[model samples]
Target: MRIGELARRSGVSERSLRYYETQGLLQSERTSGGHRHYAESAVDRVIRIQTLYAAGLNSKKIAKLLPCMRDADGRPNEIATPTLVNELTTERDRIDRMITDLLRSRDVLDEVIDTAADGATTDPASLARRR
Candidate 1:
């Protein structure tokens, strides 16, 4: 398919697809007139790229990570290693910490919201006091 079809199917923008190509996260062949052409599998590839990005992996990491992923046959590929596992573990740990911090922040915000809702105190000092 062409870039426009891939963009429409994947729900990603053409500019983003071009950027993904530049980042080596996606691939396309050139037509005789220099237009880009992608394989039918490009749709799935683009969706996987979006999934990894949503998981907090950057383009560079996804570039490396994409090759080792399981194919449609559901078998492991030949590219996984202990080093990569360690790096992925570290990324997971970072995400865990981020989640922890966000939950804590949300708890504080909840307290503030509740206090305000109760009309307990208009003063900043009263808001600072936790029940």
Candidate 2:
């Protein structure tokens, strides 16, 4: 299919698709007239790229990791070098920390909301000023 069709099917913008090609995260063939043509599997490839990006992997990292990716399970097909394995492990740990921090923040917000709902929001500072 053409770039437009791939973009529509993958729900990624054409600009992003071009950027992926430029970044070597995606592949396409050029026609005799120099128009880009992609295979049907390009749809799955685009989705995979988007998924990696969504997981906070940059283009360079995604490019490096893409070749090692297996199916859609986020597993490595072959044994990665120690350095690459460490890098990916670090990224996963960072994501975990981010999730933990978000959960903590959400818990705080929930407490505040509950307090307000219980009508315990009378301003202590206002009371002091009145005194």
Task: After superposing candidate 1 on the true structure, give the runs of residues whose Cα lies further than 4 Å from its correct spot.
Answer: 120-131
Segments of candidate 2 deviating more than 4 angstroms: 71-78, 120-131
Model 1 lDDT vs. the true structure? 0.88
Q: Please give the range of 10 consecutive residues that has the lowest summed lDDT in model 1.
A: 71-80
Residue pairs whose backbone atoms clash in candidate 2:
none
TM-scores of the candidates in the order shown: 0.80, 0.83
**How high is the lDDT of residue 61 in model 1?**
84
| Colliding pairs, model 1 | none
Q: Distance from true position, residue 32, model 2, in Å?
A: 1.8
Count of steric clashes across candidates, in order: 0, 0
lDDT of 2: 0.89
